[model samples]
Target: MHIRQSIIDTSSLEGQRISQLRAAVEKRERGTILASKYHTAPLKIAKAFPMGDALGVIVMDVSPGLLSGDRYELQWKIGHEAHLFLTNQSFTKVHPAPDSMGGSAIRQSFELGRNAIVESMPQPVMLYRDAVLESETVVRLEAGAVWMGAEVLCPGRTLRGERFAYRSYKNRLNVYDGEELIYAQRQVIVPEQQLLSAPGCLAELTHTGVFYAFSDRIKACHAECVRSTLEAIPNRSGHPIQWGVSLTYKHGLAVMAAGTAAWLIQEALAAVWRMLREEMLGLSPISF
Candidate 1:
């Protein structure tokens, strides 16, 4: 069953609807998909696409756009030996909330079996003026399982001259092995009360990308390569994009890129993913 839908009042935008999507893959081999199911509304999780041993899935938002008080849920289950990549169809634009109190929230879950691999590589989140969002992600991993995901957060609508105009954005990510929490992350961005461009903050960078990989197969060379590859991506601009990669406290690698433009950040992220896929996962780079 789909997760319990969050109670939200969307009366301001009459006829507005909430979005729920749940999809899972038991296994996939050759070109055959197995034991899969999906239920969707404004969001969709399509069938897996096979490439060598890896399977790719496209995620999309069918809504006109994210409206105020819209709640969304997406879950994916990967069984043993299953290799899945989840990519976004386009940027997710967070529109201004009508009922500021409820706002909009999204929750995503990933459940993986032993030796399984699942990747969540979505496009950037574009925050419009007065957009307020809360997002949560929970990952359940068995021994030897691997999970990777990347996210880009945009402060506001650049073309419209909305700079750090969002009301707030909060995110919490949790990873677990068995019943123990292995890693946790929390980010709260409130532009109204905080100076996002202040020293040690966003530092005049309007966009940022963060990529994470968690696995029991972490290697020293892989981490170093990931870091260097990100740093080496050339920026035609005189002021290069600020980026770095480091080994997380857990058995994973964390990469971050900050820039004034979303395109620059996205480019760096894709390059890093390409390198990691080839060197660490033994798969060819995926261009999408």
Candidate 2:
């Protein structure tokens, strides 16, 4: 049996940021807040709130988690000058359905307003054997807005000899400003069919992750500054990670693709985020 649910909420304040939440359960839609749920919603586990942020929580034990032919979507919109951070208390593990005669799929999307900021980083995603997962995140930002995000993935678990264990996992992210595409990335992984074990692929690396920051208001030498920071660090091969920092019209973007253990990626992201917060944006660190 397949099950799903959907939840949506919208909030606006005269001087505060607008809040919106959308979640699904049992393949149905329910009007629920990020902290509350209706019938069939995922079980609420632990939620945390830090200073200068909006929402933080974890919903787990999702009934029927995700089965073949299942689809899930979540969307949020932040008003001007508002800030929000969302995180999953734990890593999301994808397991093969009992009767997975076919394959499973998932999709996630986000939209933001001008001058709005969001930071969402949890643990890495684990893909089990014979599972197929497809996730897409789309962000629409206004001119002069900012966005920072990170993602981690394991090709199954190396300790378990689960090499290329999954059928496939593809994730795509796109950022736009008023129909103008600013940044776009597409990643597709197939253990059984791809060059995951090749020197260029995961290159015998167990886990990999990427972190990026994009902002148009950054200074003229913003891209160069970011590149210098990456050059200062090292990569999985004892060299600097494959770093790419560039400047576009009204925007500066930096992407780091590192081959290392999951924990290392997390710590590196924390450091990079801190540097950007203090030096680039002059904003205090807002933990989720």
Candidate 3:
């Protein structure tokens, strides 16, 4: 496994803290194993456990949370015929970023070899008042590879009566098959600058979630199945939940949802994840 050098220029960071993790997995006769791993301060992998034929990894953050001028970079490579399920240990808490610093950022890149599979389902992000965060994820897949990922965003520390108090939140995701870009999405949320409750926006929702599945094996029937699965989820009367599923440009599907609570969005995404696993990998539901 070849790990790429960091693209961040420390000299330009002006003493800002940088944390990084690089890991690769490969399929062996016994099963998939962690082929190589490296990490810096504040970032660690708890352990790798077996989940049927797949390997499960949980990333940990030792610091309280992200602070101003903090940057995190993660790279993951899965070899051919390997399956990896990735998750984080806790919510990504982004503390208030000073006006001068602007915000913290996280960058993640995943490379999948032929017939490789990766499922990344991290916890929701909690942005405190005046918090700003910029997140980017890039996925590169070879032929016969499949990738699935999910993310949920919280308005703030709702229990503390905070809602949409963050300075800014931006996320960009790109998926590529070999060298061809297949799907891309950019989401930017500036609560102070935009009317989030307006129609076509969040509209009375406090939390939002997104899920994506990409593979050459995906078909129209899978999209319909996702829609049906989402519709079957029961929603409470007063806590309104809205969601939609759509097929991507090619070889993928995307699901988006908004709700009053983070659990509402998380449960919905989990259901979709389970359904997709069954449909694509013929695997039974495995609880986390």
Candidate 4:
């Protein structure tokens, strides 16, 4: 069930400069790339890596870095029976916006066909002092498709002694099964406007990460096994990040962790990802 798509653009966005990239995988003989395109500037796709039948590509930012008024639009399509692993070469950084009102924006869309699987794990996005950012992500999955993704947000450059100094941050993620919306996550942070360290807020935690492993085809036994595996994670007081995993919907499970160290959250998420990949894809863990 393919839907019509075009080269995406954010022309209505401020600054007007747009970079678009698209990629797809389809069957033909051994295989075929259904769609792959790029525009003004794009997150360059590097060499393909081997990971079973999945097409692995390393994502990167080719410019000095994102600046105010920069807009990046992306599309990813995994055709029927296709597999994709999306990773990044480096952590994403939203540089400080010189003009308070001029910030960067990223909008992306993803589609997965029947029996398709997509694993999207990228590094944290560090927000610098006075930085402003807006991001939205929309994903469409076929009934039998599977999707796993993880994201981490660092309050600021801890190494530079920066913490929650950013002006404003906003992100919205929406997931859909065909045309039916399934999950949504929305966040808006303004460090200057409110005390982020109060009791219910971050409580001085500098790093936060969330990971999801979902498929409409999950079985009762499989889900129970996953639940049992995730529940046994020891809550050691010395660990940098405290993490937990819980069943979300009938077909999905989510893990979220927060800590003062990035590597701790990274290690925790990587461990959970390994368990999920082995169970979901029957594949060995890929190095994080």
lDDT of candidate 3 over 1-288, digit per residue (tens):
344455333455567788999999999887789988999989999889888678999999999999988999898999999999999999999999989995998989998999999999999999999999999898988899999999999999989989999999999998998889999899888998899989888778889999999999899999998888999999677888899999999899999999999989999999999999999888897767
Put down candidate 2 lDDT per residue, 225-261, tens digits, no spaces: 6556656655545433343455544464555555546
Which residue runs of candidate 4 sit more than 4 Å off their true CA positions?
A: 1-11, 28-35, 219-239
Best of the candidates, lDDT: 3
lDDT for residue 262 in candidate 1, whole number 0-100: 83
lDDT of each: 0.78, 0.58, 0.90, 0.75
Residue pairs with backbone overlap in model 1 = none
Q: What TM-score, over all chains together, does every model reach?
A: 0.90, 0.75, 0.96, 0.88
Model 4: per-residue Cα lDDT at residue 89:
84
The true-versus-predicted C-alpha distance at residue 268 of model 3, in Å, is 0.3
* TM-score: model 1 vs. ground truth: 0.90
Q: Give me the runs in candidate 2 sitting further than 4 Å from their true place.
A: 1-40, 43-50, 53-65, 97-102, 231-252, 286-288
Write the number of the candidate with greater TM-score, choosing between 1 and 2. Answer: 1
Residue-wise C-alpha lDDT for candidate 4, range 1-288, written one tens digit per residue:
564374344546756556666777664445434455454565777556555567777778887666777777778888888888888888788888876457888887788888888889888888888888888888888878898888888888878888998888998877887777777879888888888888777775778888877688655555566556555666657654556667664466777888887777776777778777887778888885
